[model samples]
Target: MTSHTWRLQPEGTAHDDRYDARADCHRRLRGPYTGLGTLLRSLVPDAHRARPELVAHHAVEILSAAPELKDLIGAGPQTLTSLAVPNERTRLYPAKRTRRLAHGIIEFLHGHARERGHALALRFDRVDEADHTDQEFLAILLRRALPDLVMVTVHTGGTDLIPELTTTLAAHATHTIAQHPDEHEDLTDNHKLALAYVESDGTSHDPAEQAAYRRVDAAERARLHDQRAAELRRSGDWSLCLGAIPYHLEHGSDREAAADAFLEAAEYLVSMGFYHSLLDVAGRGTALMDPAEEPRKYWMLGTKVTTALAILGRPEEAERRYIELRAMFDQPMLHIFSGYALAMLYTRYYPAEQKDHQLAKAHLNNVLAMASLLPDHDQRVFQSVFNRNGLALVELQLGNPTEALRLVSTGLADIDRELPAEKHRLHRSVLVHNRGRVYTALGRLEEALADIDTVIELDPNYPDYYFDRADVRRRMGDLPGALADYSESITFAAPFWEMHYNRADLRLELGDLAGAIADLGYVLELEPDELDARINLASLLREQDDAAGSLAQIEEGLRHHPGDARLLCARGLLALDAGADQAALRDFDLALNAEPDLVSALANRAALVLETGDHRTAVADLTRALAIEADNPDLLYNRGYVHQSAGDWESASRDYTAALLLPGADRADLLRHRAECHLALGDPTAHQADLAAAESAASSPNAAADPVRS
Candidate 1:
């Protein structure tokens, strides 16, 4: 029989006979096989690397010439390799000692078969010491070597399939061939012969192994880190990359192996969208991967950064890392996570210097420009949960609130709710919290509340939920409810400026002036830029007759938001109360100019105008105020006073009439004011009617007379 091409890959240490036999097989046949002579003519791992096809042809021509067993090796115009062989038990796992070696040889042979069809051949192993009937072992080896091939195996030992190998191969492999559980007391000798024949015949095979299958752990079984590294270095084959990395990672063949392993994982992760698993295995993926992977890399990097920033307290370094990741990734979700890291980094430990946004943007833009090439669906869905989370945050940052909500909702929908209880709770809580934020931003307060409430129910321990939900409740006018939530938030995130400010607002509403003032003070301490808190604190102090504190608060607030209209208005009103009309006038004028329809500003300035003897301008201000809020008692009464001063009795009477229609009309106050106006106009009878009405209504529920300080 003629021999077939066979590449000799030395196994074990350099001195072993087994290793020598492998090397001898190739060198001895070098001159005999013309195909090998042509193939082995070139070099490898160099400028003259030989082609696999050439090497294969040469191997075939030489190996067929002098086979010790012609029965197992042949070079007929047949389908397989250049030889035909029979199944043998010796090669069937090779009796343990040779099992690993047998696996390697078989694997390489099958790989040759895949690279060049009918140019390689192998023998199959059988169970029951029976002839090889296309055994499952053969099929598994083929699938690993050439996944597209169709082959089958027989399982004589009745049991359920274990799919550890299914991870590397197909999920399913074969069916039971042992017809009866009782061995054959039920079948005659003739029936037994049929079983034997069928067992010895080739039956099951599939080109596409989509169905489930039994696993075979040959790769792991044959694992030898040192041997594999030596082979890879010699073969210079790219296909061996997976095996090499695992060897380095699992064993660290040498000191350099650990670093090499990390580099390989990094490259793989960078190539595979920076998959979270690769990151988990790599220890700190951000330290290894390039930022060009965009959202994927940013997310993985964010976790490392968050962990480092929180523990090591290297906020400056954290910010720098954040910038690098942001440069490579511009997705909204990435922005959010990185934002959280950077925010925490700065909030807990601010940098002595500012960030580098301009440089950061250029890098991030590169990622965006590349990511934009992917279809919209690619942006809508990410393969990894980390990437998906990053994508959602990116949507939030970019003002795509609708998309952000959709992504968060979809993300939660895709998860199995019955997972590890704590893990599930954490995931659900995070999802709901994020969704709540998006909804609130969209002004869908009811929807936002539902999400926030779910998050709170799922994990009340998380602080941001309380603070965030408190903000929503406040917006919905649930002051007491908002206060409760804010209080809880402060309990969890005691130092947060947002929670303090929100609670302060609720405290003011509940008439807790001291609590409100205290909260506001803390808020300013946390974030000096909080003008609203400062103003609110001043206003509350003024209500409590703390003139000095009130003025001090106003001045403090102005230091931060100097041009704030609300601050100006509040300050002007306080100045007026202190009888500093000129100071008040300056503020009110500026306030009104900032917001022309400011009711309090217009009204205050109207009185100031009167004090300055600008009757025409004061009338104009009062008339405009009444137009803005006709039902406001102060505006109506003030406008009437302006009209009366102008001797416009018709306008003055109209204003008094409108004021009397307001809630809790203050019958005594209205009648007294109106009676005076009528007397001034020389209407005695009208004044008499007004006096009668005033005396009767003064003690009634319709009356409440007290000056309201502006």
Candidate 2:
């Protein structure tokens, strides 16, 4: 098999400021996955052939995040509505979404390659100017996809790509080419030049074209924008609204139309979880209008931007913008909306040290007060219940589970009493879900399970509700039920590594070691840098006597997380198991230096030192390990053995006595050791009592071998 190359060149140039070049390409191509889908369709012309459902599943997954593609994908109204519903229970972060997309694409490619013995090559130009969503998708695809299945050549405008994309190119690209620009064409016709620029969605980097386009009068340029926007609107491809339509209208003659387009796009992007894009488009819309004159439109855009800021981890900026907007707009609805947003910012998005539940509660109260002032009684009731759900979350975060439960109950009651069952279905589901969470926190597992079950019935398509129900079932000791729920969750969504990770633990608990291993391996495939999954997988592989697999996992984890203490300690234990004592000692020392209080490293190192007859060092290591695990009988027993070996009878006697007092202690051995120590310390009465206890324990059926000796 010949190895294919993927090239990326990110070039920086002037006159590329109008729009994101790569995003424009994406819009023109319909979506990020369209090329792959087209290739698959070409490979198998019959729509029934080659698992088209897989392709459609992934297409739906991408559409869920970028719903503007509904027109291009021919998604039905019901399908679009289902995909558009915001999943409040689980926040699928951008990176995870990228990983899921990459996984789905690779799966599709592999299936195609299996049936049709052929490889595909794809190229993308101006990748540096791609939007965050496209860049992240390309970066993950480059890193994870097999080279033989698909070769990607990315011609970045410059080397100014995002850090992740740049790193992926540097590490994965097979060849790098630097090409100098040729002489620019003499474009004397201003009309032709401006047309070319607009037709390309402002992706023209030609200096001559740029200069000619700039020479065109503003009236003509606005006329061109208006024409382009009308053309895109007539094309019936909604995805263009995310890019070309909005870009054209923003530069069009009508400022109000531009603001309206941007506001619509902002709301669409926000729902799609494209917060960075939402922030940009919303800011542009805000710039085109005055807050004082267009307060409602301005507040709508401003609130979306504020939400984007908070979701993007800029809480301070979000807070500042919220305050600025609130001061500018005195409307009750503005206060209600912005107030709820600010409350969520404090309750969820703020840094841990900066989070203030009391402050969040105050904001929620303000939202409720504003809601009451609304003229419409139904609006007041709906807003009150909606904001009260947030207040419940704040109370939960404040460690007031009872109060949170009460708040959730009141919200549910109001929704049921005041609103029709069909009204506010989404919010009703949210309240039920929040109530479930509160019940779980309050240790009311049955109630939590009931609430989760109800929410799952209400919104059966959402995966997080199943995951949440699984958790409650797990806590309720319904292992089989929890396992089924977890499987159902995985089935409902694309690929949630977290659900797999949790299910792996559940499988392990149920003694399905193979299932646990498979789930953990899948988790690593979805997220390679998942250190906890790596560690658990390594340990599980070792349990199954696959030492090589375990070592590979540890090495791979170390490659990502060098000097990680848990990994190092695990490596040390593996080395010791293989009789590489010096290597084990070195790794243990390194692990300890990285984390001094690492109990496992300390205890294992104590064992190694004891083997070398370093009794004092062994005793010191065990003593420190004991500090971290005060009630550990094994550590106490080991320390007693080391002290006894060092001829420290008093210390040995104290340690042995402590070990005997612990639950599940090796009673016969501990008693015998304590009797010997007591005799050595000349405590005749204590020695006699311990000797009698030792004899009695040895005869007991429940007695086991000494852990220290074993």
The TM-score leader among the candidates is 2
Question: For model 1, how does the per-residue alpha-carbon lDDT over 390-470 read when each residue is reduced to its tens digit?
Answer: 456655655677877787777676543323333333444566778788889999999999988987776655566778888
Taking all chains together, each candidate's TM-score versus the true structure is 0.42, 0.90
Local accuracy by lDDT, each model: 0.51, 0.76
Model 2 C-alpha lDDT per residue in residues 260-310, reported as the tens digit of each score: 988878766766566767777888889999877788999889888888788
- In order, how many clashes per candidate? 26, 8
Off by over 4 Å in 2: 1-50, 65-95, 115-117, 183-187, 683-710
lDDT for model 1:
0.51
User: Mind sharing the TM-score for model 2?
Assistant: 0.90
Model 1 CA lDDT for position 674: 89
